[model samples]
Target: MKTKRRAAYFFTSLKLFLREYRLFVLLGCLCLLGGVVVGVLSARSFGEDYYKLNFIFELHSGSYSFAKTFFLALLFGWGGLALILLCGFNRWLIFPAFFLVAFLGYRLGLGFVGCLQPSGAGGVACVIFFYLPLYLTAGTVFIVYICMVFSSICGACGVFSSASSVKRLFFKALPLSLVFAAAAFFSCILIPLLYKLFFM
Candidate 1:
């Protein structure tokens, strides 16, 4: 009964958060999509050599180890969260955050294009097994963090400029941010394991 109540409360809070910040979520998605489209188009012009030069591709080509992958993902996830927190202090910082999210998408697009180069089937599998989980997890982290930062900004700024408003915003976002962080960490761990299971 206690667990059931907790679960219900969690869902209700999640629904409220989504309802309140859906526009920010949509904006993040659009930016990511735009970057992806650009990356896919550019990949065709740049050719395979260009993607080979990419750090992610280089890493992917190397040994698939759990520690290395998890460390890298954790680094990126923490870095993204740091950027979002920085953005909360100043409006100008949001531009860099936006660019970073889009850049992630661009990288994803490059990976997808590289995978699909020779044939479709293997590429589809790679996307399913690897790219979707890894990049999508990162994307989810960014979107949630960005939404939280945006809300905090609104609370601090002229809009919603009450002490209680700011406090409420911070407390509400804190738990969600922690949840996303854990999700990102789990994805990092999961990705390498998945690679070993399917590819190795």
Candidate 2:
């Protein structure tokens, strides 16, 4: 009975959050779409030749270590920040959270373009098979963060009990963010192996 009651309460809170921030969610979706559009337009400049040339050089020259480290650091760092944002609420958190979402969306979009290319098909396959899940998890976490930010903003302006309730509501998202972050961290190890298999 206690477990059931807790589950019910969680669902109720989720529903209230969705209902309250529906517009902001829509805005986030639109921004993601815009990011994708920009990515597609920019894809023409990121030709297969450039990708193959650089990727081949990196494989032969051992410069890929820098890249692998950078990618892991970036993804893990973003995940960490998202997790932190999930447990707190501040009106000031909105811009950075949204920017992270937009940037990730744009990169994912570019990656999709790369996936569609014949030369990049194998790498894209790896991304689809492996990185896609991680990216989706990260995206979900960011969305939740944005929701928290919006909620905090409203709360700060008198919609609720100020920072206390905002903090309470935001912390409710912590479990999901932690789950996502773990998956992303584990997935990071696959990066070099996948690159070797696909590009090397």
Candidate 3:
């Protein structure tokens, strides 16, 4: 009887948390969808190195061979992360940049992008293996934490401070973005290094 009651209570608590962090949950769901889409599209385009989401440029042996693949990863990963953050206005990001990039990239008819666009084929993993799972987790953490902080601050300010909705939103987003960026960045490094240790 106690076990069943405890389980029910735990689930009820979980329901409360979920209700409180609905924004994070929503962002998590969308980012998850984005990851799968990113992963699949990457595999189709990058072939073997789809795992690294590099080899699209910098060449295994070419003129810019000294530049390395890490640059590609950083560049695109940062862009994608920022796009996910700044533009995620309640859905699919509120900006045309993300929309256009996602569409222009994803809507190439499900084939390989390297073949289609000369500058295509840069990508990375989105599937749940480990470590990288925290990429989404970190982002979601930021989302939830920001909401909590934002609400708390607004409440502190009596909801009628000189701060407009835009100001409040900015406060919520900027700090959260920075925190998430740090977590995500570290995760990206950690994932590759950890994977390398085990596999390579």
Candidate 4:
């Protein structure tokens, strides 16, 4: 009964948070999409030169390593969560959070282009099978963290205009962030295993 009550409260808090900060969430999504489009266009325009210019492309073009993929995904997930959590203390940190999301999206764009170059339809399938889950999980975590940070900043700035309100917002965001973090970490860990099973 206590567990059920806690679950109900969690859902209620989440619903209120979404309603209050939907615009910030939308902005986070747009930033990611915008970054992806830019990356795609840059790769298309620059071709081989772009591959040379971007170290991430070099990393992607190399042989696949389960250890490397696992580590990087772990870093992307938990590291991003850490960064977003820190952003709550200073508004300036928000810029880094935004950049991190956009940068991840850009990396995804470059990777998608690379996948298409050799395999065509098979490449698309590879992305759907392998990359999509990892990136989507990371992206969800990032968007939520970004929103939480933004909301915290607003609360600090008196946008919420009440100490109790600010505290309530923090409490709501804290558990949600932790939940997403765990999900991101597990999803990332699963990706390398999935790749090894199917692609390797």
Candidate 5:
């Protein structure tokens, strides 16, 4: 596709995904609800043997703790898109990106939940503020990949994965890769800004 057409397709793709406001609003509602609940739950509270963060809490309510979990899930959902695109780009790196993004999300989620504790505010208060927003931003980056990946794979035969098609997928993913990097950058700026916006 010509550059203009391609960019237009890309923007259209964004509009289509944004139309599903429920998923985003669902998360937003969860975050708001968390602060209103009366108890908290930690990773260990669930007894999972997987990687765990030791911080615990008894918050204004448990509603916020559950909201943090939703935030984390949304975060990993970003990594999941990154993984799918990694597969599209250099099939070889797919698995690594998948695990790394997932690990980041899980560990970060744990840390964030810690901050939501009734008294857990301080320097990283900013970090906690942007968790959900970052998830939404990164998710858009992922959605673009989904669009490109689907276009590349939809009409192909069962077994003959074409190198040209892979290349196209990679190129399509280039902007999103930049987007992910930029998302991280903007996230750094956004967190502090969000902290001021919400807490200052």
Candidate 6:
């Protein structure tokens, strides 16, 4: 009964969020698409020689590469969540959060650009097997965080405004943070193992 109530609340909050923030989400997605378009267009200058470079393929090998990728995803996932929590208290942070969303979109775009590479099957495979699942999960979490922060900022200043608001925000943030943390965990372990299996 309690679990069902919690699920109901989650869905209610999500419905409200989507209705309220649809425009903002759409804008962010457009920015992400634009970044991807730019990344693909820019890759034209990279040339066949650039793709042919052995270092590009070789970099995917070794424990160092996997370690770096795992740590970076972990850092970004948790760090971004931390930032969202910090920003929730300050309305002034909305602009910066907007930019951060755009930047995340840009990085996603770059990943897509890598997959679109004409000659580098290794790069394509890396994007597909190693990066896509992690990014999709992490990126969804990021979008949720950004939207939550934005919503929190819009409501009231800081976490101490009211007892009800505090409780509400906590409940909302808890699931999103847990989901992102799970994504980070998987990105660290699952992504690396998959990378080794396919790429190595």
In angstroms, give how far residue 146 of model 6 lies from its true place. 2.6
Among all windows of ten consecutive residues in candidate 2, which has the lowest summed lDDT?
48-57
Query: How does candidate 4 score on lDDT?
Result: 0.65
Write the residue-wise lDDT of candidate 3 on 68-187 in tens digits: 433443454445444444443333233343343344234222223322333332233322332244334444544454344334333323333435754565465565556555554444
- Candidate 2 clash figure, as a count: 0
Residue 92 in candidate 5, Cα distance off native in Å: 17
The Cα local distance difference test for each model comes to 0.68, 0.60, 0.44, 0.65, 0.47, 0.62
Number of the top-ranking candidate, with TM-score as the measure: 1
List residue ranges in candidate 1 displaced over 4 A: 1-11, 50-66, 154-200
- TM-score against truth, every candidate: 0.71, 0.61, 0.39, 0.67, 0.45, 0.67
lDDT of 6 by residue, 1-200 (tens): 99999999999998987788897677666665666566556655554333322223434533245456567777776777667666667777756655666666666656555545534676666566545566666666666766765665544566445567557766776787677657655645675566567756
List where candidate 3 sits over 4 angstroms from the true fold. 1-17, 20-31, 34-38, 41-48, 54-134, 138-163, 189-200
lDDT per residue as tens, model 4, 1-200: 99999999999998997898798777778878888898788888887533322222333555445456556766667777766766666666677878888887887787677766655565665466555666666777778867765665654543245566556655755665566555544444454455446654
Q: What TM-score does prediction 4 earn?
A: 0.67
Instruction: Rank by lDDT, highest first.
Output: 1, 4, 6, 2, 5, 3
Writing each residue's lDDT as its tens digit, candidate 5 over 118-153 gives 334541443444444554455455544544554345
Tell me the alpha-carbon RMSD of every candidate: 4.6, 5.7, 8.9, 5.8, 10.6, 4.9
Number of colliding residue pairs in model 6: 0
Query: Which ten-residue region of model 1 has the weakest summed lDDT?
Result: 50-59
What candidate 6 gets wrong by more than 4 Å, as runs, is 1-16, 43-60, 115-121, 154-171, 185-188, 195-200
Please, what's the RMSD in Å of model 5? 10.6
